[model samples]
Target: MNKALLMCLLILPGHAIALVIDSSKPIEISANMVVIDERKNISTYIGKASITQGSLILNAEIIQLFSNQQSVIKIIAKGTHKQLAHYQQNQPNQSRFIEARALNITYLIEQELVHLKGKAHLVQGFDSFSGGTLDYDIKNDKIITSMSKDGTQRVRFKIKL
Candidate 1:
C-alpha cells in the first residue's frame, strides 16, 4: 500500500508468529479522499486508501480508523465489491515479504490482534493459511481460523518445515 490516510492506528500483515510494531514511529496515510469526524472519534479514508508505518503497508477501498485521546485504538479496512483488502511488509530482518488479504480486515491496536474475515488468506514467507475468518494474536503468537456459519467455507493451511 502507498502512504495511507490515517495517522493513529497502524495495521500489519502475515503470520501467527507475531510481527512487532514499532509504535514510536510515525504513521502516514494517503487516499483519494479522507474524512475525519472529530466528534465521532473516527477517521475514514475512501477510494484507494493506503496506510504505511515503517515497513508495513496496507491497502483497501476504505479504511476506518478509530482513536481515543491518548492513542489510536482500532483499524477497520474493507475491500470494494468482493475484492480483497491487503497488507504487506518486508523489513530488513525479515527473510521475505509477509502478506495478507481479505474482504474485511480489522486490527485492535492495544491488544495487538488482527481479525481477517471473508475469504481470508495469509502468507508468511512460504507458509500460508486460508479460511473464512482468521484471528491472529500477536502477543501470544497464535492463529485461530474457522469456517463460515453456513459451513460452505473451509480453512486451509500450508506450513513449511
Candidate 2:
C-alpha cells in the first residue's frame, strides 16, 4: 500500500484512521467573535476562522466546540467550510491530498462520528466523492452518506471499511 495509506492504517486505533497534520508551525486563526462560557465551560470561535491539527486543516466561518466538565463532547463547523490541502510523508514515500469544499459539519465525540450536511466533496488523486449528507464513523472506518430530498440529481456513497 501507499505510505500515506499505510500510515493512516498503522497509526489508527483499531479500525479508526488517523488524520495527520504535519506543519512547521501552528495554525494561525483570526476571528470576529470568540465566546467562552466559563459557567458552562464551553468555548466557541466564530467568523472566518481556520484550524490545523496535524495534517488536517479546516476553514469555516463558524466553528463551535463544546466541552463538559471533563472533555470535549461535540464540535460543529459551518459556513463555507473547506480543506485547503494535506501532505503526508513516511519511509521513502510521500503524497498529497486535497478537498474542494464542505458545507456543514458536526462532530459527535461520544458517538465517534462526523456528520457532514449540504454540499460536501472529497478529492484524492484522480478519484472524487460528492454528496449532500455524509456521516463518517471515525472509530469504525465507515461512511454512511446519502443525497437529500432533491431527487436523483444528488450523489451519495456509503461504505463500510
Candidate 3:
C-alpha cells in the first residue's frame, strides 16, 4: 500500500512483472542496516541487502528506494565493481524462473522498465544471456542487450538442449 512497501515488492521482478503483481502479498527486506528518510521519502538499505517477495529474491550491496509524495519513483540496487547484484524469480504459471546479476540494477517504477549494467548476466529457463548491459521493457515485453565493442567483449547467449 505504501511506496516503501511497493519498492520492496519490485526487487522481485518475476512476481512484479511475469506473474503480475499481487500487491496484497507481504514484502520483506533484510540488511546490515536500513534507513528511511521520511522527509525525502526515501529508503536506503546497505551492506548485503536482501529483499524477498514470494519466491523471488534480490541481493546487493546497497538498495535504495526513491519516491515522491505520490508514490515510488525508482528503485536501485548497486554492487561493488568486483561483486554483482543478483535477482531470481520463480514463475509458477510458466513453470520456470529467471535469474539476473549485474554490478548495478535499476527499476523505473513509472515505466516498469528494468536496466542492468556492468557485466550483466541473465538466465531464463534454458536460455542464458551475458553482456555489458541489459534492458527489459516490461510493458512491451521486449529485451535489448549490448556489450563493449572492443572485440574482447561481445554479447553471448546460450540455449541448451
Candidate 4:
C-alpha cells in the first residue's frame, strides 16, 4: 500500500504519548497488501512489509500491529527461516546502530520491550549476541537471552574492545 495512506491509518493522536524512543518522529510504512480489522483493532501487512521512523527500521514478510484508538499497543513481525525478520535503530549519542534478526519479533510498545524468538541474533556497535530467544528492555538498555528448549543452542556473546 502507499506510504501516505498507511501513515494515516497508523497515525496516533498528536497529544497522545507514544511508547517508542523517538515518539515525536513521523512513521512511514509500505507493503504489498494491508488488511485492517477495526473490530479487533489490528492491522496486518503482507508481503514485504517495512516500517520506518527516523533511524529505526523494521522489515519482515508480514507485520501486524495491534492498537487502541489513541496509540499502538504491540507490533509483531514474522519471516521465514531463510529470511529472518530484521530490526535496526540508531543508538542515542552514538554513530553505530543496533541490528537484530529473528524468525519472529514482538514489540510490546507500552512496556518498551522487544522479544525475539527463533534464531535470534542482535548486534550493537561491535558487540554481538545470539541465542534461541532474546528479550531486550529498551528502557533499561539491557538484553537477556535464553537457550533453546531442546537445550542444544546456548546463548553466545562476543564483545570487541
Please identify which of the two predictions, 2 or 4, would achieve the higher TM-score against the true structure.
Answer: 4
Candidate 4 clashing pairs, residues 3+ apart or interchain: none
**Where does candidate 1 clash, by residue pair?**
3-30, 4-29, 4-30, 4-50, 4-51, 5-29, 5-30
**Pairs with backbone N, CA or C atoms under 3 Å apart (clashes), candidate 2:** 20-55, 21-54, 21-55, 22-54, 22-55
Q: Which stretches of candidate 2 lie over 4 Å from their true place?
A: 1-29, 81-100, 124-126, 156-161
Which portions of model 1 show Cα errors greater than 4 Å? Answer: 1-21, 90-97
Better candidate number, 2 or 4, judged by lDDT: 4
Candidate 1 C-alpha lDDT tens digits along 1-161: 32432232333222211235433455667788877776777788899898777666789999987766555678889996566899776534447776789999998877977899988888877889889898876556577898876777699999998
CA-only RMSD, every prediction: 5.6, 10.5, 4.7, 2.9
- Report the lDDT tens digits of candidate 3 across residue range 107-158: 7857867788888888877888888888866567567889855544478999
How does model 3 fare in lDDT? Answer: 0.73
**lDDT scores for all predictions?**
0.73, 0.53, 0.73, 0.81
Q: Of the pair 1 and 3, which is ahead by TM-score?
A: 1
Residues 1-161, model 4: lDDT tens digits: 76646554554433222334565677777889888777787788889999887677889999998878777778899989889999987766335888899999998878878899999999978889999999988778899999889877699999898
**Clashes per prediction?**
7, 5, 0, 0
The numbered model that scores best in lDDT is 4
Candidate 4 backbone overlaps, count: 0
lDDT of 2 by residue, 65-160 (tens): 566655556767776525421211121122434443557777676786667777765543344556777675655745566777685428744333
How high is the lDDT of residue 48 in model 4?
95
